[model samples]
Target: MHSVCVLGLGLIGGSVLRAVRSAGYPAWGATKSEGDRDAALADGYDVEASVEDALRRAADEDALIVLAVPLTALEEVLRQIRALAPSCPLTDVVSVKGPVAEAVGRILPSVRYVGGHPMAGSTESGWAAGSAELFRGAPWVVTAEEETDLTRWAQVARLAIACGAHVIPATPEQHDATVARISHLPHLFAAVLAAVGAEGGPLAWSLAAGSFTDGTRVAGTRPELVRAMCEGNRSALLEALDEALGRLGAARGSLASTGGLAVTVDAGHEARRGFTATPQAGPAEIRIDLKDPNALDELLDLGTLGGRITSIEDDLAVGEELGNP
Candidate 1:
């Protein structure tokens, strides 16, 4: 694509806009706030005055218009894009895909929109949080419908490649359901753990250990961000919650067995050992989202480049818990 419009110059949107520029595609963004517009411009991301302005500016250009806004704002963006003429392609970076695709279908018959989720983010946000390399080596998920424009889809794939991201294709519903388990559910569980620890006051915090810290890491996510994600994917989140509860029930059953705590301890030990196996080229590239760039860079420099079909050795032979979608 020659040019693209990125709506909502926040973290994910700004990052993609920046990456598009780095990939040599002329890029521009739309934002509601003057401060955001200025910030994104200062960060070297082209800023457009409004959505209509962005679409008009990108008119007749082989460009992609992206709505990087929250899931809550998706419907409005889709409506506006639907009203636009059918020259340029439209896409989105909303975390949940199912609702976004459904909404777009209802309103935009000829508007070619694709759903995407960059499996990367930071604790930070807003236009001031823009970065071109923010998505380097991250998983760039694209979910397309049967009517999706193949040429536009290929352009998006190329964009992902330029950003050093691995491409994973799925349907909108599949993307939503999978993210409910891996992304949304984890956030919920982490917050739950944090609240439990804080329940006992400062003393409880003092007693928290490594496991607690790692397990509850996502609990530190920004409130608005978490609220948006959970609410947007409520249906899948509910299903994820049921599955998590079922796993918890199984663990409880084990703990309540004749051996009780001993069985639990053994199970925990086994779980811990899985991560201890000699670092093998995993059977698959561990496509992970990094809230911190430095952290991901360190791993990459350590020779953990993602996208390999599998690890050099078959670590799965030892029966590690498989991470499902």
Candidate 2:
């Protein structure tokens, strides 16, 4: 935890560098290019550009090592680090844990590795996108395993806390499942919906206002990044997609019936009223469906829920009654 080597000086990696420095830990970074090195050093990050220099500064087996690269590059980096700094407690910020962790155990059996994913980041990149507060109050998921060293795991948790993140521990399988529902599937649906809306070109899009903007905003980020996350967590993502498609199909069915849509809307309203809290400071209020477990967490950032709350008329929650249909 003294000196840390952060691989990939992109948005999330650079942010971790900033967080490490802020936490009073000596931090260094590895980047493939000189420009990224210059950017990290120039940002006053306790970050050195070269892995050798970074490792020297942090000094081996004691420092934490974070792989901030994409999931695809995880194995290569893991093998490299295993040779370079074998004793360091390694972790990654990759969105999908299953693939990365499995790859690590299979490819580099000697290294002590734990899978990590911080549910925070901006669409922006490079050194300038780094933020010490990027992880503040964000859910930093740590994947738990039976063979995991508890003491080493604590070191990882310390970093999460130091970064201002709220820590949540889970098995890699459960972590993947939860993230598929909360993160991946949403991005997939959003991208598809945005693509549909873009079909008519400028005229079709010009009519899209705030609602459209808010709905598909995430689709604007790097598509490959989204795809990598989903593909890496394919098993969980597939299960989540199956469940989500069922909801859509059921909604379509309800819409086709006389007053069925109203029934569905009413049910949403009723369930929302019980679970969601009212806004504390908004002058105007609106109700929104809040069956999603992450709704409240998201609402904390949103200025208001638009007074949007609802109750299920039949006392039924769509995904609740039928599991993946």
Candidate 3:
């Protein structure tokens, strides 16, 4: 991999810089904030004072630029990069992909843009909270559109893997939609819960336990950042919110009508069980408890016809069950 130049030395950007530098890659950073620049220098990182200077140095050194700025600030940076290093392939760590892709398409028509979003980070903000291990074992979604440069996308994926993230490929639309359900809606939900809990004042806080704290943890995130994310993907977020509200409404109706929450609770338990089930390694093996006379033959026929079966055994069955009349 080539050297990396990360823009915006906040938590995500700082973490990227640290991880890349630790992996023996030459890494440089550029931040608009003077205090952040000073802090990066104090941490012994090779950070430039300005984005233009950083891009100039990185271009000369053949480094891949990683845009780690917020979605709202991305267009300006994209335009700057357009003026500075228009030909170089770049990637971003923005939370929303659709908006970034659209901005890149408009500002950087000629440059290769690899849109990425790492499923990691904490409620904390700024470089002080950044860690080299922040991305370890996290899913980093890389958006590849129809006209996407495959080589550039792979380069971004390699960078994510270097930071210990598993690369997940998706289109910008797909990425935005998935994160709407998994990330944006959850943050909104957490915010609502936090607001409700605060209604009870000191007593609510005193009574808060693992469930309350854990569920509302994301509400501690920077308000501006969360607002930007929600606004950037508003359409998808609205869809997710509607679906969640519909489910909740149904659950409420079920509880009121039946005078019991077992149906809703049981369905939730089963869904959660399936969702949290540990993934098994290797090829899936199915065990059929045959009660019909021709069930064994039917299963064998399906597997054999599909050419997916590697082995078969009738020994698991009791002698009486397997015996012919």
* Cα distance off (Å), candidate 2, residue 256: 3.4
Worst 10 residues of 1 by lDDT: 310-319
Better model by lDDT: candidate 2 vs candidate 3: 3
Candidate 3, residues 197-226, lDDT tens digits: the string is: 999999999989999999998898889889
Q: Pick the candidate with the highest TM-score.
A: 3
Q: Which stretches of candidate 3 lie over 4 Å from their true place?
A: 201-209, 283-325
Mind giving the per-residue lDDT tens digits that candidate 1 earns over 109-163? Answer: 6676777787888899876676778877777776645555544555665666666
Candidate 2 residue-wise lDDT at 170: 68
Name model 2 segments beyond 4 Å from true.
46-49, 52-61, 200-203, 257-259, 262-275, 278-325
TM-score of 2: 0.77
TM-score for each of the candidates: 0.80, 0.77, 0.82
Estimate candidate 3's RMSD in Å: 11.4
Between the candidate structures 1 and 3, which one is better when assessed by TM-score?
3
Clashes of each: 6, 19, 0
TM-score of 3: 0.82
